[model samples]
Target: MAGFDLVVRGGTVITASDRGRYDIGVQDGRIAALGLDLEPGTREIDAESLWVLPGGIDSHVHLDQPQPPGIVQADDFLTGTRAAAAGGNTTVMPFVAQIKGESLRQAVTAYHAKAAGKCYVDVSFHLIISDPTATVLGQELPALVHDGYTSFKVFMTYDDLVLNDRELLEVMEVARREQALMMVHAEGYDSIKFLTERLERSGKTAPYFHAESRPDIVEREATHRAISHGELLDTPLMIVHVSSRAAMEQIRWAQARGLKVYAETCPQYIALTAKDLEGLNMEGARYVCSPPPRDEDSQKAIWEGIEQGVFSTFSSDHAPYFYEGSEGKQNPKARTSFRWVPNGIPGVQTRLPILFSEGVSKGRISPETFVALTSTNHARMYGLYPRKGTIAIGADADLALWDPLREETITQSKMLHGSDYTPYEGMRVKGWPVTTIVRGQVVFADGELKGEPGFGQHLARELSPYAKPGRPS
Candidate 1:
């Protein structure tokens, strides 16, 4: 018999804090050894001239979400996880949204049904607490946290989902007491609503107005408010999808004061701008998303945040919606008003490639920082650390082999997502992941999928060390 189940040889293994040319030995889906030379195995892969990095962990994605009547999400667990795998992601975390009048447990059960036996990569869940009732906060939420649903998100905007200040405080108290991480979508709802109504009445209803209605000040103010709430409650909070320099400054201020205010920024903030929402007719609807992309100055600020460590994890926030379908971006009412347009773009399959080409290939960041932002930090923040986000012995053997010189012009036809279009279509990127392995199994290689839907498993997470209240400064 061979000495090991598998061996990957001759690749420059890159981790968040280390890099070296090494061979890896795998046994029973876990890394058994890493050294200059490993014992011969039953299977061997020659990884010469490639960069072997930890598989990405996209901790924020939307798959098979509950939508309004005329709106529909494009990808379910099968297609979403497949796209994630193609992009070199071995794990993804999508939301289980609790609707008003429903129990949080019920929402989780329903989401599990949707994801059962249909994923191509491992999955975890975050709870969207839309209805924080007495039972939820006093009982259900704590129980769920103990049961491994250790993080939950709350909205400060969206009319149907927003929580009042008292409600927000109640939720944060639970998070602090239970040591569960709290994530906030920080956009001022009343301010946006005020501007949106005025714009609609003035007939400024184009998709471009979507950006105008929710300007940087709204995000800035809401971010500051959220940070203050976390401070008051002595809780750690993560502000999601920050898109403006002003908002980033707020987070920096909190951090300087020794507050645990983590921040996240998506690819849209770096690659696109308000101008993308000005496409002629209804075409611009494709770029519509909450806290819409801002000006070039804002883009520069986002890049600075990444470099300066103001941002914690870089996520895709992939919310897939088709452009032409009636139930997607082009819903009948959406054509008439920006408010009705589905608020997202597809990017699960392109998130890492964009960062690799733009950030690492251009020397804006080193390969080590790339691994930290795309993989390691997410694992640390979401409680999956050494097990899923590194190449250490006894960890899951999840890896992505990259061709640092490969160039490709992105196109929807070349993508594996279920969406009809990609917002980054025609954009050129210099580096790409040529092979992806999950749990010691080669799942994607040479532009083909080698894994099946049921190969992915659901993960139960531990309470994140980074999220514990009163953590060291």
Candidate 2:
């Protein structure tokens, strides 16, 4: 009988801090050992000249959430996770939104029902606290954190979801007490409203105007305010999907002051520019995600942030909505103005390719930094560390085998997600994940999904990885 279940041999294994050739032995879904010459196993994968990396952990994604009647997300857990697997991500963390006047626990229960038997990779939840009542803060919040939903998101914008400063402080206090992390969607809602009204009055309702309404200053101000709140309560905060140079500067300032203000940026900010929103006719609506893409200068800033460690993680922010028909980007409300169009872009599957091609291949970042941004740091910040993020003894055997020289142009037909269009269509990428392993099983191999929809399980998270040293657990 073979001593181990499987062995991946002759590959250059890479992590945030180290890289080398090793034979990885796996048993019962956990990494058993790494060595120069390992014992034989029942199964063997030849990884000669390939790069074996920890599977990307996309800590920010959206799937199966309730949307307005006409607007529906094209991808749910099944398709979304399938896409993630194909793109080299072995784990995905999405949000569980708490609707107002509902029990926070009940909201989680309902989301669990949605995810049941549909995920193709490991998954977790970050609660979207839209209704932070006393009972929720005093009882439900702490209980959920104990149950492993240790992080929550808050918004300072959106009519139905935005929380005032006082409410934000109350919620932050709870996070402090419970030792949970807070991720903020930092955009000034009122400033957006004011700019949007002025633009509409001036007849500047084209998709391009969406950029004008939510300028860099808006994000910069909200980021500053969010950091101030974190400073006041002595709580750690993470700013998500930072899109502009101004916002990056705000995050840098906070970090300089010794505050635990972490940052996350997306591929759109690094690759696409606001000019994409100028697509002819209403085509520009396809790129209409909030805190929209900025100019070349902003793109330069995003790359600089990655190189400087100003960003702790890089995520897809994969929010999928169809591009056509009444229920999607063309909803009657959207036809009249850009304001009604849902704000998101689908990039769950393309995130890694774009980063690897633009960052690693172009010499903007190193392979070690790539692994850290895409996997290790996200796992660490979101509390999945040492288990799902690294290629060490006793960690979950989630990994991606890569062909760094593989070249291909992106197209929707070749993709696994439900989105009708890809923003990166026709863009050539230099690197690709040829195989994705989850636990000890091959979920995606050579561009095909080998795992079933229910193969993944739910992950319960711990306290923030960025929490100060010596802080109470």
Candidate 3:
């Protein structure tokens, strides 16, 4: 018998652009071959009829950061990656943020310490420039990019994190020079703040008001401004959590102009809506998030954007905040006033199955498109391509075996995220990961995590293609 580390037999292998039934052989933490069965191996897993694809890459997540008073994320690197693996994702890229008055280098160092050896799978970081000083804009940023910290998010919304036009230009110039990607949280801070104060005075103190305060106009306007800024800087940009039709139009308009503007839509944008927050009592607080989910009409626009290829990738935006639990804001029940309620939901453990059921089962997207949005595109845009998001010979042996026939009603308690409530609670989903492999090792299987907590590695990523600013050769 030929010696191999492991053999995944009887799987219908698939990638972002192709599919076939094959037996994949893995050895020394890499794919040795993926074709017909030719030899035996140490471990053989029967994946007959299952969807064996590249492990998902969740490009947007906030693993651990002190979001400060009223909102602390529940999952650290340990629990976050566990839930990610449970959801069939073998790689995740989270932000390492620099708060105002903090050093960029120091902040990155601190984040690495918090995440080291605690992750459940391979992970990387995208830095956030909350304070773009000269040192950060010059030496530190360039050095970090070369060291594999190639992408960063710059906010245009929150007072503590938002950057003005001048500041944004400076940040963009640095990103352009370093060939790094910039992801923006595009919401007009001044406009949204004006609406928030106005709504409070108008006696609209309900969870639903959170959506109204920063209506689609706010998101669209900021999307336009961010795209324009990138154009002026000749850099590429990605607008995260685009939740409305108007915002999609802005990105579409920019792309039509031949701008490298990318968009990402989350599961919340497709699965939930403003009506979810209309529920009575404190129950509605669960649906609250920054740039809140729009109504059913906007949901349709998001779905259309997916089919039409407006969104280059998909992510969980997995910002966990416990609802009525020890890890949550003290007053999780308070529905009104954005300050009192935390802005996030636990979905890292449920993103894939929801998309598979709603998109694939409904024929809105092909299984190949699913892999593209969930894996390949993410790796390509984020500079992790061919290594973490494909089924090639040299890439990491990260795989997700999906059982399409499986059925289950998702509940917060059933997931491993630290949150006590899921906005998706009671929703039924089909198709989920029966097994997840990282470095040829099965970490999630038979409804349980089969490995220890410290098996994950912190990946260093080169500058992303989108982050590399350019107009042409």
| Local distance difference test values of all predictions, in order | 0.93, 0.92, 0.86
Itemize residue pairs with steric clashes in candidate 2: none
Q: Best candidate per TM-score, number?
A: 1
lDDT of 3 by residue, 26-70 (tens): 999899987897488899899997989899999998888877665
- Compose the digit string of candidate 1's lDDT tens values, residues 287-361: 999889999999999999999999989999999999997999989998788998989999999999999999999
Number of backbone-clashing residue pairs for each candidate, in the order shown: 0, 0, 2
Backbone-clash count (model 2): 0
lDDT of model 3, residue 71? 61
Q: lDDT per residue, candidate 2, 270-386, as tens digits?
A: 889899999887899999998899999999999889999999999999999889787888888887788988889899999999999999999989999999999999889988989
In candidate 3, how many Å is residue 257 off? Answer: 1.7
Candidates sorted by TM-score, best first: 1, 2, 3
Off by over 4 Å in 2: 468-473
After TM-score superposition, what is the CA distance of residue 12 in candidate 1 from its true location, in Å? 0.5
**Ten residues in sequence with the least summed lDDT for candidate 2:** 464-473
